[model samples]
Target chain A: MKRITHFYSLTPEWQHSFAKEMGGELIDNKIIVIPEDIGHGYSYFTQVTPGISVLYVDFVLDTPIKITRQKSDNELYIFHFDMSEHVNLIRINKIDYRIGTHEDLGLAIIDNKMKSTFKPAVGDRTLAVRLLVDKKLLDEFIKTHPSEEHGNRKISVPKKSLYYYDHIDSHSMLLIRSIKDRSVFDSSFESYLKGISLRLLGNFLDRYEHSQAVKDEITDVEIESVTKTQTYLLDNLYNPFPSVPFLSKMAGMSPSKYKMIFKKQFHNTPKNLFIEEKMILANRLLQSGDYKTLTEVIYELNYSKLSYFCSKYYELFHRKPADDLVKKKYNQKCITKSTLQ
Target chain B: MKIIEHSFGPDLDWLPHYAEQLGGKIDGNFIIAPDNGIRYILPCGEGISAFYVDVTYNSDFHKIQKNRDTDFIGLYYNLTDGEATLTARDFMYNVSRWHYNLSVIDGLINTDYVVKSGSRTYGLAIFIKKSIIESYAKKENIVINQIEEITNPEKNTIIRFDRMSYDSYYILEELHKQKVGGPIFDFNLAGTVHLLISNYLRKLSTNKIILQTVNQTDLNNIILIQKYLIEHAEETFPSIKQMADMANMSESKFKILFRKITGSTPNVFFMENKLIKAKELLEEKQYSISQISDKFHFTNNSYFTSKFKEYYGLSPKIFIKHL
Candidate 1:
C-alpha cells in the first residue's frame, strides 16, 4: 500500500483476479502477497492452486533493458510486456516486481487470443452459459470452448519473429529507455540507434559512464563540443595531432571536462577515438592491400613512435598487416584465390 | 533531393521574439538551408535539409530575417556547430528578377534541439525552396520556426565502442568469447533485434568482412557450410572439426551458431554440404568408374563409387551418361 508504482503479481492470483466464477461473478480472492520486494535483478517463479490449476511467471524488475535508436533523445517512455516461458513453480524475488505494471500482468496472453470480429459455429450453437470480462471488442475472444489450449489452427511463427497486431485504441508508445545500466539517449530517431544500444551496456568490455545532469540540460554548447570532438577524431586519423590539451582547445573545453563529455558520447577518453581511428584506418588499408610492406604500412599510418599501433593491429587483425594482406583480400572480397572450389 | 514541403500550424513563427509583433499569427518560411558540404552534387537548391530549432543558441527574435515588407529573393543559412547554433545569410541568387537581398544571421529558438543524436553529432543547416515560399507570400506571410521533432520510443539505450566502461567492454568481450567445446550448445532465443545486436557486435569484433550482414549473405554462408560438411563426416570424420577450425571458432560455438543461423550443426551441416556436392558430381557422372572416385577426393575409388551409389542409389557410370 506504499503507493506501489511497480508490483509483480503471481500468475495464479493474476489469472484468478480476472477469472469468472460459476455464478457469473469475478473471483475476487485474497491475493498472495510477498514482502520481500527487492529493487532490481531478474526473478522467475511458478505456483499452483489445488483446484484452480498451475500458474507460473518470470519477471525482471528495475533491470536495465536495451533499446536502439537511430536518433538521439527526441522522446522517452517505459516498456512493459507479457511474455511466455514455462515455469513449474512460482518463486520470484525482488527483481521483476520493481517496475511491473498492470498491463505487464496480462497483455501478452490477452493479445494472443483476443479478436475483434464476430463468428460462431452454426451447427453446435449452444445456449452460452456466461459472458467473460468486457463485452466490447475484447469479449469477442471469449472461446466458444474453454478447455482448448491453443487456437483451432496453429500459425507457425519462426524464431526471433515479431508479430504485432492491435486495435486503434488502447495503444500508447512504449519506449526502451535504459541498457544494462546506462542512459545513452541523446539525439534523434534516425542517428543514434546503435549508439544507444552500446551506451546501455553497463557490463561492457569498454567501460563508459553517463551523467544525468548533462542530459537534463543538454545545451547547444555541449552539442557543439561533442560534434567538434568527433570531427577531430575523423580528420586526425594518422597524427600525433592533438593530445588532450590540443583536443580540448579545439573543442573549447578544459581537458578534464572534455574527458567527461567524451566518455558520455564515445564511451572512452578523447584520445581513445584517435587511437582506434589509426587502427581502423590501418586495418582498412590492409584489407584494401595498399601497403607493399609491413614497414611501409606502419610508417604510412605513423605508428613509428608508438609500438601500441602494431600491437593493436595484431590484436585487431589476428595477424600482422604484411602477412595478412593476401588473406584479408581473399577473405574480404570473394574473388577466388583458387579456381578449384 | 526530393523537397517535401508541407504546412505546419498557421501560427508558426520562425523568428519568435526577433520579429516585430505582427499581431495575429505570423507565418515565416519554414527554412532549412543546404550546407556547403556534400559528397556530391545532386540538384535541388538545397542538400539534406531539416526544419528544427537550435534550442541551445535560441533566445527570442535571434533567428529573424526579412519582414513581410521586404521582397527577399533567396536565403542562405550557416550552422556554427561549435556554438550549437544556426545562422542564416539570405539573398537573391538572381537579384534582377527577385527584388531583395536582405542578409540576416538570426539565431534559432523555441524549437526543441537534438543533441548527440546521430552516428556522431553533426550540425545541419536546412533550407526551404524559394519558389515554394514565394507561392504563399501573395496571400499571407509565413514564418517557420522549427518543424515538430519526433519522440523516440527507444531512449538512452545505445551500444558504443569505448574501453573505459568495464561493463560495456565486457558485453563486447562476452560476445567475442569462443566456446571450444564440441558441437551442440544452448541457443538463447531472444528476438530478431537481439540476434541482430549480437551479429553486429561479432562482426565488429572480428573486424572481418567475411560476409555482409544481409539476410541472404548470412543464409548462404550457413547453407554453403552446411553443404560442405555433410558427406565428409564418415568413419573418423575430421571435416566438421576442420571447418570450425577454419573459422577460428570453438566447435560447439560454431555448431550451435551455425544451427541457429541456419538450421544445421557442424555434422548435419557437413552432411548437407556433402549431399549437394554429391548431387553436382552425380550430374557429371562420366570419365572412369575409378577416375570419378578420385574426382571427389574419396579415399578409394570403390569407396567413392560406393558412397555415390549410397547417395544416389545408382551406380556412378549409369547415373552419368543417363543425362
Candidate 2:
C-alpha cells in the first residue's frame, strides 16, 4: 500500500497508477476530476471550503477490486456517505466497519499511518461522497458552536486511530441530494458545489460535536475498561459469561457503576449483550454449514440440550435452528444441480 | 494604536473599506487585523452592527469613538486582559475584562468612549439602531421600557454595566473561533450577533439591580418570585392576585413592578420559560411531542405545537426530525 499525507499529493499518484483505468482533469487549482470512463461513471474532487474537500464518486465496475492506501500522519478526518443500496465495508487499522445506504455515516480520524481499503462489487453501481477535512479547521468550527460537553476541551486525536458509524440525519440527506444534483450551471458550479458542501459539513459537525460532548463525560480509564469488557464478552460468547460483579472487578469498578456505564456506552445490559452475541455467533456458524447436525451445532455452542439452543436461536432469529440447516442444505443442492445442468 | 472614526448605519456598505483604513485587512467578507491583533466588523441585518476587537499594542490612551449620528444602543463585551474607563462628559466609569455594558448613544451629546492601552484587549461591540429595536419589540409584542426610557431625549446617556455570565462568556469564546469567509461566515456572524444581543437584552430586562430606585426588599422579592416561577415551571402559574398577596403588594402594583423589573409580563415570562424548557427537551430526543406537552402541562398537543412554532419558528415534530 502506498502512504501519502496531503490530499493533493495522492491525486497525481492515483492518476499515474490508474492511468489507463481512470483519467481526470484539474479545476480551480484545487479540484481534480476523473470524468466518466467505460466502467466508472464519474468522480470529481471539490474543495468545499478552504480546509474541506469532497470527492464525489459514482462507479460501475466489471470485476472486484481492492484499493488500499496508507494515510500518513496528517490532521484530516474522513467521512464516507454511502448512497448506494449495497453495504461498503471499509477496513481501518485492521477493523472492518460497514457503511450502508442512508442508514449510517462512516467516520475515520487519521492521525498517523493507517491502512484503508475500499472494495466495490463487480457489475454493480456504487455511489458515495467522501469528505476530507482539516482537523484544526473542524476543531475551530466546533469551538465556536460548542455542544453540551465539548465546550472547553480540545479534540483528542487518539494514538490507536478511531473509526465509528453515526446515524444519518435529515441534514446529511440534504447534503447528499445537493451533491447529486447535476443541473447547476458550469459557470457557477464550483461555488455552488462549495456552498452545498459546507452546509453538509456544518450539519455533520453539529451532530459530531454533540456526540463528542457526550463522549467527553466518560473518563479515559472508564472507556478503556468498557472496551475491555466488550472484548471479553465477544471472546467468551459461546461459554457462560462472567457475572456483573466479576466483570466489574476486572474493569476496576463496582458492579452497579459498571452496569450503568456499560449500558450508557453500549445501550445493553451485560447479560443481554452476552445472549445477543451468542445468538449472532450461532447464526454465523449455522449459515457457514460447518456443523452438519442440530446436536453438533448445539454442542459446539456449549448448549446442554438441543431444545435450549433451539429456543434461544428462535428467540433471536424468529426461526428454528433445524429450519435454517434444512434451508441451507436445500440451497446448496439447488446451486449444485443448476451448475451441473 | 491607530484611531479611525466612521459613521455607520443600516445601508453602509463601505464599512469594510473604512475598517481596512484603520490597519485592518479585508479578506473577502472578513476584516483581519494587521500585525497587532484580529478584528471583524459584520453588519448583521435589522440595523444591527457587530464588531470584534482583539488589539494588542502600547499606548497611553487610544480612544475608538463612534460618533453616533442616530439613536442606537451600544452593547460592549470585554473578553480578557484589558482595563479601560468609559468616559462620557462629566461621568467616568472603569470597565475591565469579563464586563458587559449597555449604553444608549445620541449624535449630539452622547459620544461613545472606549479607553484602551498598549496591551492586548479582546472584546465585542454591537450597535443596534433604536428604530430597529422598536420594530423588533413591536413584532415580538414584547415590552422594552428600559430601551424606551434610555432613548428619550430628556434622559441622560444611560450606561448600565454588568458582569458577563458564564453562558455569555462561552458564546464570546465561540465567536472568537470563527475565521471563515463568504456567506457561511456572514451566516454564523449574524446568528451569533442576534443570540448575543438577545441574551444581553434578556438579562437587562429581567435584572432589577440595574434599577437604582427599587428598594432592596422589593428587588429581593422580585428575584424570589422569578426563581419561584422557574422552579415551578410545571405547576399552574400563579395569578396576579395570588402573587401580589405573596409579595405583600397590591395586585396593580405587583403587575407594574413585575413588568418593570423583568421587562416582560408575568404570563409572557412564564410561557417563555416553558418554551425554553421545551426546546431543551426536544433537543434531548428522549420524549415524543405528546409526552413533552403533557409534562409541561400544555392544554393539548396542538396548542403546544402552535406555541412552540410561534416561539422557535419550527414545530416540535420538525425540530426533532432535524435533530
Candidate 3:
C-alpha cells in the first residue's frame, strides 16, 4: 500500500505536494489526473467563492492507497460526500467511520482541526466530493436562519471540533449526478463546476441546520437502532416487505415505537420505503435492456402479480411498465436507425 | 400603460416592497398575490440571485424597466402564454411562445418590456455578477473578449436569444414541480439555478451560429410577424404574399430573411409551433387525439398522428403514456 500525504488548503504547495506524491502531473493548477498505474481519473480542486472551496474526486484505484492529511490551523467545515460503489473507511482523530454505500447514510461533515486518513476500497470506483467552508461564514449563516429553539440548540464553534454523519438525500444525489455528467472538455467547464459547487454547499448547510434543530428529539441509541434497521431494509429490497413486528424485533423495540422512530429518521414508513426501493429496482431492470419480457422483470423483482406490480410502479413513477417497454423499444429502434444511417 | 421601474442587483430587498404596491405580501422567500400569481427570490450566494415570477394582472399593458448601473449578465427564460415585447437598448424582441425563449441580456443596459394583462407569464431571471463571470472565464482559459465587447454598456447592447434545449426544458419543469417551504426547497432552488446557469454557459461556449447584424427595422418586423404566427398557431399559415406584405418586403426577400433570422421557413415554423401546442394539450390530459387533431385543423387523426410522430419520435398516445 502506498501512503499519500495531502492538505486541504487552496494553495500551490498543497496541490504540488499531492500531485508529486501521486506521481501525477498537474494541469492548469487545478486538476491532477492520477497516474494510470494507480488510478484512472482526476482530482479537481478550486475555490468556488471567496469563503468556499471544493475538492472533487472521481477515480478508481487499481492498487491499495491511503490518503493521510495532517491537522490544520485553518478552521474550516468540510462536508464530504463519499459517493462510491463501495464504502470509504476514514479515521478522524482516532475514531474510525465507515462512509458511503448505504443509501440512507453516506455524507460526513468534520472540522479541519482533526487529522484524518482516507482509505478507499481498491478495484471498486471511488467518487467523493468535499466542500471546505470558512467557519466564520458558516457561523454567520447559522445566525441568520435561527431555529425556534435556537438558544439551546446552537452549535457554537468554539475550540471543540464538530462531526456530523448524515444521509445524502435524494435531491443532493441528483445534484451530484448532474455534476458528474458535466464534461471537462467544455470550455466553460470551470464556471459550471463552480456554480454546482455553490449549490451543493448551500444544500449541505441547510440540511446541517435542520438536523441541529431536531437533534434533541432522538437519542443516540435509538438512532443507532433505526440506522441498523434502515440499512437492513435497503439491503433486502428484492425481498417482500418484512412485517412490522419482524422489523421492530430486529431494531429491538416495540412495533409502534419502531415505526415512529423509523419515520422520523428516514421520512417514510418502513413498508413504503421498501416498496419504493423495489419499484425503483424494477424500473432499472426494465430499462437495462437485459430482460427479454415484462414477466422476467416482475419475476426478477419478486413480484407476485403483474397487475399489482404495474399499479405500484405507476403509483411511484406515474408511468406503467408497458410504457417503459414502449420507450425501450422505441429507443432501440432509434439506435438501429441511426446506426444504419 | 402602468410603468414600473426596478433596480437590479444582488440585493433583493426592493422586491417585497415593490410587490406590496401590487396587492401582494411577502411570505418568507415568496411574494404571494392572492389573485395574480406568486414570485420566489432565492439568493444563492454572494453574487448570484434567482427570481421566478408567474403572474398576470387585471389591468392591461404594464411596462416594466430594470434600472442598473453595474455590469452583469441576466439569463432570462420565458415560459409564457401571453403577448409581451422587450426592448433592450436598440434591439426589440417579442417574447414569443415556445421557440427561442431564452434571452441572455446585458445588465448594464436598461431593459424595458410590456406585458398584456389577463394572460399568465412565467419567467425566471438569474442575475450573475460580471466580476464572477470574469473570474470563471479567466480560470477556465476561455477568452471572453467578444462577450465583453458585446455587453459593453456604452455600445449598443446585442442580446443573444436561444431556443431552450430539451434538456434545459426538462430541468425547468422539474424545478417547477418542487413544492415551496419543504425542508430542502431552498437547496433545490439553488441547485436548479446552478444547473440552468451552467447549462447556459456551456451553450455560450460552444455556440457556432454567427450573429448577423440584421437591420433593426427588419428584425422588429420579423419579430412582430413571428409573434402573430405563434398567437395564431391553430389557424392556417397565411400565404407568402400576405406575409411579405405584412413585413413590408417582397416575397423573395421575405423567404430569404425569415429563414436567416429564425432558422426555419415561415410555414415550417408555424407547423412546428402547432405541434408543440398540440403536445402541451395532450399533456394536459383534457383532450383526446381526435379532438386535438381537429382543434389544430389537421386533415384527420392519422395525419396528425404521423406528423406528431415524425416531429417528436413518438405517437401522441405513446407520448401520453410516457408522460
Docking class of 3: incorrect
Task: Write one digit per residue (lDDT tens) for candidate 2, span B122-218.
Answer: 7777777777656555644545555445334355444555554434554565556656454445545555565566555445444544543466477
Model 2's alpha-carbon lDDT is: 0.62
Looking at model 2, residue A223 earns an lDDT score of: 69
Candidate 3 residue-wise lDDT, A19-50, digit = tens: 99889989888888899999788878877766
Task: Report lDDT (CA) for all predictions.
Answer: 0.32, 0.62, 0.73
Give the winner by TM-score. Answer: 3
Model 2, runs deviating above 4 Å? A1-341, B1-3, B13-17, B58-61, B68-71, B100-118, B137-159, B163-166, B177-185, B211-323
State which candidate, 1 or 3, has the greater DockQ. 3
Q: Which candidate should be chosen as best, given DockQ against the real structure?
A: 3
Question: Which of candidates 1 and 3 reaches a greater lDDT?
Answer: 3
**TM-score of the A chain in model 1:** 0.32
The DockQ of predicted model 3 stands at 0.11
Evaluated at residue A232, the lDDT of candidate 1 is 69
For B9-86, candidate 1 gives per-residue lDDT tens digits of 112333343222322222333222232111111111212122222222222212223333222222222222222222
Scoring each candidate complex against the real one, what DockQ results?
0.01, 0.03, 0.11
